[model samples]
Target: MTAQYDNLATLESWNDSFKVSPHELPGERQMRARRVSGFLRARQAELPVVPAQEAASDAASGIADAGRKTAQIEREWVSAQWGLVPRWVKSEKDAKLRAPKLLVALNETVSTTQAFRDAWLAGQRCVIPMQAFYVEDLRGGKPVPTRIARVDGQPMGVAGVWECWKDPQSGAELLSYAILTINANNHALMRRYGHPGSDRRMPVILGEGTYDAWLSARQDKAREFMRAYPANWLLANPVENKKDKKPKGLFD
Candidate 1:
């Protein structure tokens, strides 16, 4: 979802591409990869035999449903403005809210403050699916926009967290999500384009194999899987700002 604080063109493009239908909400858009050999081998070594059907059903019904059911939940309508007021927030209908943009700086001290600390501590892991995400670069003092996605050209899931808030008056529930960031991995293409620092923060990319563990309410395993993702997995490039005065190509 585009936030109001973001550039209008950026917001419009996001809404147009993502929120096409009335009931359509922005779905997660991160890249997905098959389970790598290492993780698969490790899992196989760890769990040699499948559990009984009944126990397996119970675990899947409980935890597996969390992610899927949560995914089906929708946010209340708000102007595409990024603010602290979570989509799930239902109290104070007209209250003017202010919040940081969803894209957070990982190493910054503010990230460790109350706003994010609780979710992290609570083992609240989330996945932000994105068709694409934007990045800015300066060339001759002009900000250039780049669209980043998977080299294999698939939607990606940036790790995220969801907060459920209750409306003080009616006791209605609201759910909101946020993207997590960490230092970038060293990839040759990202370096060549001067995309940003290898240390520059990026979304916590979750591998497909780990989706179950990450989404599990089991905090310990989820935390262990939250380590930074590999750099070589992402591909990025410049794109035209279609919302601008003239439809310029990436070179512009």
Candidate 2:
């Protein structure tokens, strides 16, 4: 499964890229593990589990449909869609109308639209738990099929915002989310990636030390945690993409 975003690629099938791991990603384990560096094995102890809370309001969004899903890591990981459906949506068909974007830029949210304001001030915040995310290796400002992960092998927690909507007919509430991004033009690791004209953005990855503060911070206090992760701590590889698409769709 792959989640397309901002015409970019990634390590997990989530976001605007596809994830390929030595270990198949966990389906429902809250204590998820990234693919082991050299081998696929039963290994949960080697990595730390990201502490996440499924949005309190979305616990009942009846979006666990058989055909589509959204990804949100909570007490455990589950197969979910990579898009965020507005809490006001009433149909799957209507969801396509918003042309969901997978990312929400912090600077832009302050005045772009009411939805962003509501999500921000309402504390609709969420985090995408990732082992690694993909970035294009650039040469002449073009994207080369490549992936990136943590050199230290610890999972990265990406900041995000979530919303819940209901199916008009089924009355089932569904939860959808978007990852937060920040400009990375100054970061060596992230600056090295992106296609020509592609936004130089990287997910707002939080360390174990800051997870709770980020998750619980009020709107006015959230920005302090948006800084970029140091570039030297990551690893990049030229793994083949599991599947590629004819760049279509918007971010959600």
lDDT string for model 2 (1-252, tens) is: 012222112335332221224234433322112111111111122223222344323323422211112223222233334555666666778776552443344545632555555566776565566666665677745466555667876666677776666788888766555667788878887877776666677778776545544555434446756778887887777656556444565542
lDDT of candidate 1 over 1-252, digit per residue (tens)? 111111112334334433312233333222112110001000112222333554445455643433222222222222121222343334555323423443342433323655555555655445444555666655446666667667765545455654445567877654444566554455443333333333444556666544544554333324334455555667667666766656558567
What are the runs in model 2 whose C-alpha is more than 4 Å off? 1-80, 96-100, 103-107, 140-142, 241-252
List per-prediction Cα lDDT, in the order shown: 0.43, 0.51
Task: Report the poorest 10 consecutive residues by lDDT, candidate 1.
Answer: 35-44
Among the numbered candidates, top lDDT falls to: 2
12: Cα error in model 2, Å: 18
Per-residue error (Å), model 2, residue 120: 1.5
Per-prediction TM-score to the true structure, in the order listed: 0.54, 0.61
Compare the candidates by TM-score and give the number of the best one.
2
CA error at residue 210 for candidate 1, angstroms: 1.1
Clashes of each: 21, 25
